[model samples]
Target: MGDKVVKFEPITHVIFDMDGLLLDTEKVYESIIKKIASKYGKEYTLEVRSELTGRTQVDSAKIAVEKMKLPITIDEYLEQYHPLCREFLQTPDLMPGAEKLVRHLAKHNIPIAIATSGNEWLSKIKTQNHVNLFSEFHHTVYGSSDPEVVNGKPAPDIYLICASRFPDNPSPDKVLVFEDAPNGVEGAYSAGMQVVMIPAPEVEEELKRHATLVLTTMEDFVPETFGLPPYDE
Candidate 1:
């Protein structure tokens, strides 16, 4: 709010959203959903896929079925999607700057965490498959299927829970959140943290009101680029 630029030195921690932010896995899921919908004679449009961007699988399923007026039920959607996520995770594609950004942050010893609405299976892919990439982090918060704990994106419960886990540094002002969706940006802002919105071009307007700094991609997130300290002396 004070200065639009993020001087990262004063920031004590970084919280990342795993899907579109850290991995290029969102498109995979979108493809899977469309394929499934096609097989079942349901229409899965790009507009619908865009709407489901930052939601949990279950919630998205609900929207697809109830809100979108699809023929599938929530259980049926999960039945189709669970195995799809597992298959997708078996060979995930990392977002362009994911490796470099995490390595740089780790080298500088910045405390980091992954705050995702994804469940255990996706978390396994992110944390275990890319263990070396994020093993240095303190903890990971994979919000469960419990409705109370997870209102999903745009509601902010998940991000708030992630921030509260760092009670020693509870005030969100000390943290910087990295997000790739407007809903994620809203959630981080709702949690009271400063957020950098790195959108995927489809949802640039989603970030307009919520983002502290809106950028096209994470490729530009260098520590020194933001005037933060370099890892080496």
Candidate 2:
């Protein structure tokens, strides 16, 4: 069969996924997961890592414990992983072009929000070093701990909630989502929003097919193509 042609529609509001999308923290996550997995003599492969991406912390911990056959409880895993994660997450660098794009959108009066699987506490820790960047968002919805978000990525709850929180409460179709995981793409798509995926180099091509647009990095994103204001050159 021929590849499906993806169409771009004008977007009025934007939603961003955190972690790998905005912060260069995916490597820290992979490193920590691998370190923990090694203790149980299990390899933390990219495939398994992909499955855990975009999930809640408890969900991810359960999956890793079960999939890796670790001799540890979910609580135990959290106890070990949380401290290690906090150490590195407190100072994550902004992903390439993330700050520029965010500030550009903010400057243009484009409504922007964040929808992340990371709970409130973890999200705060991760963004501690980049308060100015995050403060540009209209609002942020932390799916893992938000009472309003019943499900994490791969479910439309978080995205829907994010859109509803916007001042205009734009329809899902008018909201454009930026994501870095296949699950995040699926969630945004399921929410009836156009999603631009900036996937890790290690992510499989098949997983990227679901996105309305896919790019190597946020730097490559063209706001004009999506009916947003062009960046000042």
Question: Number of the top candidate by TM-score?
Answer: 2
Per-residue alpha-carbon lDDT of model 1 for 150-203, expressed as tens digits? 478877787777777764655677778899877778888888887888887766
Give the top-scoring candidate (lDDT). Answer: 2
lDDT of 2 by residue, 131-215 (tens): 8888899899998899988888899899999999998899999999999999899999999999999998889888987799888
Model 2's lDDT to the true fold? 0.91
TM-score of 1: 0.86
Candidate 1 stretches greater than 4 Å from native: 1-9, 145-148, 204-207, 224-227, 231-233
TM-score of 2: 0.97
- What local distance difference test score does each model get? 0.74, 0.91
